[model samples]
Target: MQKDIYVVGLMVDERSTKAPDVQQVITRYGSNILCRNGIPSPSRERGIITLTMEAAPNEYEKMEQELKNLHGVTVDCIHFSQQESFQVCQK
Candidate 1:
């Protein structure tokens, strides 16, 4: 099995009401997380978080499912695999 790199984005609509639960779920999957960055909305009522990680397909799917189950949270993910390569050329 090959592991892939994934970037996950989470948006919490009611930060004060939902942040704690979201944090707990994130903690439960701490080992799979490589780095995390979070920012609060200007009004302080919402939050956005970005996570970078390396995980097996199943591991990521499970985390996505759990996060999606939260009432006021939205999750999105982008994955990069070893089989894909990118290059930039200037003309």
Candidate 2:
């Protein structure tokens, strides 16, 4: 069996209004997250967050869905195979 790497990209508009909720969900899935990076826009009105994760398919989807449910937040995921030479399995 081959292991998979999951990369999630999150764009949060209206940071002041949505960051708390985003933080809550990130905390809920803390164990599955391998790395996290967050950057705020120059005007401090929005934020971009990227996460590297290792999780079962179901759990990953659940986390993505949770983030999507929040207003002013957009989420995207990329899946890569660890056994291959940087092969991307999904986007």
Q: Estimate each model's TM-score.
A: 0.86, 0.82
Model 1 TM: 0.86
Enumerate residue pairs that collide in model 1: none
Q: What is the Å distance of residue 85 in model 2 from its true position?
A: 7.4
Off by over 4 Å in 2: 1-3, 82-91
Residue-level error in angstroms, candidate 1, position 76: 0.8
Question: Can you write out model 2's per-residue Cα lDDT over 7-28, one digit (the tens) per residue?
Answer: 8889999997899999999999
Looking at candidate 1, the ten consecutive residues that score lowest on lDDT are 82-91
16-57 per-residue lDDT for model 1 (tens digits): 889999999899888989999999776787899999888887
lDDT at 57, model 1: 76
Q: What is the lDDT of residue 83 in candidate 2?
A: 56
| Candidate 1 overall lDDT versus native | 0.84
